[model samples]
Target chain A: MQMLRKLSAGLLLLAVASFASTPAAEAAGQTLEIVKKRGHLKCGVSQGLPGFSTPDNRGNWTGIDVDFCKAVAAAIFNDADKVKFTPLSAKERFTAIQSGEVDIIARNTTWSMHRDTALGVDFPVVNYYDGQGFMVRADLGVRSARDLDGATLCTNQGTTTELNAADYFRSNGMQYEIVAFEKADESVAAYNSGRCDAYTTDHSALYAQKLKLSDPKAHIVLPEVISKEPLGPLVRQGDAAWNDLVRWTHYATVAAEEFGVTSKNISEMKSSSNPSIRRLMGQDGSFGDNLGLSKQWAVHIIRAVGNYGEIFERNVGVKTPLGIKRGVNALWTKGGLQYAPPIR
Target chain B: MQVLVLAAVLGAMAWLVGNVQSNLERQNINSGFGFLSERAGFGINQTLIAYTEDDSFGRVLAVGLLNTLLVSALGIFFATLLGFSLGVARLSRNWLISKIAMVYIEIFRNVPLLLQIMFWYFGVLRNLPSPRQAVSIGDAIFMSNRGFVVLWLEASAGAFWYGLAALGLVIGGIWLRRRAANAQITTGQATRVWRPLLGLAVALFGGAALMAGVPFALDVPHLKGFNFRGGLTVIPEFVALLLALSLYTAAFIAEIVRAGINSVSKGQREASAALGLPESVALRLVVIPQALRVIIPPLTSQYLNLTKNSSLAVAIAYPDIVSVLAGTTLSQVGQALEIIFITMMIYLSLSLLTSWAMNRYNQRMAFVGNNT
Candidate 1:
């Protein structure tokens, strides 16, 4: 009996070793397939950026970036709620996506050339157009960013804002000290507590974080927008189908809005005669097929999160506490920069 | 059978690495050290060496290394001083001093180091009055939310000669100490070395200052338009990091120190007392040397802990190595594997070097054969 048990234990060890030696190449090109097999989409998001991705007391995530991931889930599973959110920090977001800890990263990550070519990830579309800006206390007599000479600024570490703030200050011949914190709220707390003369970030985030101050009305964002920050959702490289699916999910929402298709009226508007709307709604084309998604992908997405305008208005529009206007994020028809190509 | 098992483990590891390498190549993420030379476009808040946004990543890494070393060395020095005092105080006969030291160790060591860091940074330092309302320390130091600004001495060309004079005085002090010890050993008479040492310091430094025309001029920080204009500035983040690291590490070191001192047998002290040596001399000569043997190995570990814990400076944005280089550079270059590997290796080597030095010291303190 002892001999038999030893032989069985040796066989079990050999089996475990064989399983461990399986190569990673087989897992490289099938993010979509794996996510499908896993029965849900794993979405990477910020830990808590108020208007972008914040969790409620009930632990339900609600934000524009959260809406984007929900839309992607609806496109895949026809159930917007069939997605889990992994709250990642600025330092861990890219690695989370790279390691396949999450299938897609819908964090408000800026689309930069260096990240695109270097990080082995592809940013599908620019969901929000933002620029770096500064906010100072009204009592500081600092009217513009140029008046920010010798200012100590507080910002989150491991972000583009740090480099942008450095560049803007150096070029403008201002000597500034930046006190960076690991989390966004920590930096804001430092700024709110008077540890710094000013706080800087993407202009939209500045507005979102300003509301968190003790006296929100006491700080004014500076006028100068330093760098172009085109924030978007991204996926790992080497998966073209997965990349295309994410890209088209963003485009579908924009196209639905341009065609005057709201989630409330999407079912009723299905009978409309505009062929562009028809193709976008997946009414009469192989568009979703080409992207390897079901034909009703656009309908599911629009139904889940409404059009792009709806998501923006609900989370961060002028009516909301964030009060961010869709200046450059509006549709091209409305003289904004958001323009998507025809589905056909 | 053992060799076969080891071979199997190594073979499995090799296969896994080969698989990962192939996957990384397929995914087009470049893996190498060549990218270390690329321009690091980020700026660090505190730099010991000259660094700009235009400097290469390698230089930034160098700056980070210097910062890490500065904080660690400073932390080790301060922690040791503070720990030794607390340890001695813990054994004090006075009820108040001993209890106070006990309370201090319990409070600092029991609470998380990270929380203490945040409390010092966000709760204490950040809430200080603004720069314009900075609190003054006499006329040489200023404290505010902006930073700790102190009057710095600007040495002119003649200051180099003064530095030489100071060096000579230090050498003279050491020589006088050795001579006094030799005299006591030979003549069985204790010589008072303090007077000569103090006189030599005062005369040498005073003469150097007069000859060099009072070379150092104090540059006090003055209020500028929005902030302080020009003294040596210690940013609040750095202050908080230093304060938190030293205090927290000191608590652990105190416990180690108390244990070490307690490890010296009571018989030794009693024997020294019987030999008619003073209590102070018994502690300084007989007790401490023996206690240090027990103290140093664990004390070395504490020093290493403080160095490693310095990485938490990232939480408060002090721009230590883990913060500036590993955090920012890894994100920018997209060389997570390479950057993380290199960072781990750097820390590994740092700990190894520290252990090696401490071990050498330990060996020196160790009792020789038949000495015990």
Candidate 2:
């Protein structure tokens, strides 16, 4: 009986110990604190989307999205390289963030009502504004999307592009068939191999994917924008501090652009008399400290990834293979929608 | 002591469930089956049922389930047919025939099913001519990279009566066969049943067709804008997925069949021969029934594997349950936990149904008690 009591006591202790660990596991949702403890930020990115997030031969990732994650890493660790990227598909991206498999999702995910309200993740800011469009072979003679009646379209499954095409065709009273593949490259290859009459996706993505086709010059993107796809970074919900940190990381780049602060001249401009510049450069009030970071958070972000304009130009601008233009993604000062609040 | 273990297990389950609930609540994520009624604002390329973008998520699940069932049922049918043939050929007297069967079994069974699916979809089907230059069979059927387009029969309202008439013919045939067997048992006089039944069936079907004014109209496919319209299209994804699934499962089924045939006692075959039966009749009457006892349980497992592997349809965009419901709908609704749980339940139900059917067949084939 004494030995039985000892055994029961041991079992009880084990149960109690497991119960005690639940709260610690619950606190794992505090993403910023966990990142600080782990020393490296886990950023979810695309499998391989050019001009967004694509790794090179040596596994070095480069894109506007990649730069955004680097900026976040710099803010937290003060080192741009302290980031581990988890490549995810469209179907897997939300689950990865919701399950806490990644600290942030820097993949090119569209911000939508259903996702914002229903998904367990929060889209803090729009990094790139994209729109759905169609690309058809040059020989098809289909000038407008309206002429695509009775056509077969290829696109990636589990994306807004599929729904957008369906809605666009249905509302226009035009009958069309969609052949969606799980991977973006499969859809592009299908379109290239003449399995589909056209390929539809984000306009910017169409340009990037066209380069991978057998004859890149043979396809033309239709001059039609179907849906508003404000692609942005996402973080798990229930952590307002982490949400603010990610939101401000994006705004910091835009504000730096508005203040005419490039990575090359940011250090020299620190001595400027401009009040906005002084506040943004961390020469004024403790803005970063309020978010539990050093006062020079914005400085680290800008120095690591440059302003938004520089990141865009270096990765997907006019000189790049994608050659995307900053139409609505430009700063509000230049007649665009990108506007940032005052740092102070 | 057993009660204590059971209580501990139940308590652990309760804790896990509570943990998930609290976590989801904390994140403000909606968790329930309510999202199933919401609109599924997406289009599936291939659907066995009438589906549109305006359909609810519930309808999408139905469409996906039907597609999965279609592929799995057809895959099983073809795999069984090919597997039995190859198993027999493997035991052929001719050396080249047996070697050919061996080669086929080795080549297909050793390679991954996913690679085979990709090979058929990308390497073979995609290389077919474009729709503009599609190979046409008198214009009623076309083969192209897009898919195989065939002229199909469009049934009018009268087709229902014709279908009922066919069902009646089947029932009549079964009754006639049973009566013939009874006659042979009681009076020792054989009765010819099939010829009369065949004649009656033809007459009944013809009369029904005449009364229903021939209910089927030929729907021919023609090149419209970019695709063939007004006909049945066998999309390449389905064809590729079906081919890969059948060929891969057929290889394993062939081995199962071979082992079953070998397990039948040599004495059974010799006894049927001593009764002056032909080799084919002896094999079918004496050997097969006994071999089936060994073949069934493993064959059931192979069927389950084939059904589960159909989930790989997503890789080739076949619009099966995993692709349509779990991939697109879950992503759109952002209800991962609920959607995944539902999908798991669906697969479990399908597997259980398959196992139950196979067990019924096995019971019917088993020998009647100790008489053996």
- Give the Cα lDDT of each candidate: 0.87, 0.89
Q: What lDDT score is found at residue B155 in candidate 2? A: 98
| Model 1 Cα shift for residue B68 (angstroms) | 1.9
Candidate 1 lDDT over B206-324, as tens digits, reads 88878887787878789986789878989888889899999999999999889988988888899899999998999888888888888999999999999999999898888888987
Instruction: Report the poorest 10 consecutive residues by lDDT, candidate 2 chain B.
Output: B363-372
In model 2, which residue pairs have backbone atoms overlapping below 3 Å? none
Name the 10 consecutive residues with the lowest summed lDDT in model 1 chain A: A19-28
Model 1 segments more than 4 A misplaced: A1-27, B1-18, B194-212, B368-372
Q: Which candidate has the highest DockQ of all?
A: 2
- Candidate 2, which segments miss by more than 4 Å at Cα? A1-29, B187-190, B368-372
Residue-by-residue lDDT tens digits, candidate 2, B1-372? 656656766676676677777777777888989989999989998888898999999999999999999999999999998988898888788999999999999999999999999999999999999888999999888999989999999999999888988898999999999999999999999899989898978888888888898799999998888888988999999999999999999999889989988887777778788999999998787777787888889999989999999999998888999999899998898889889999999999999999999999999888632214
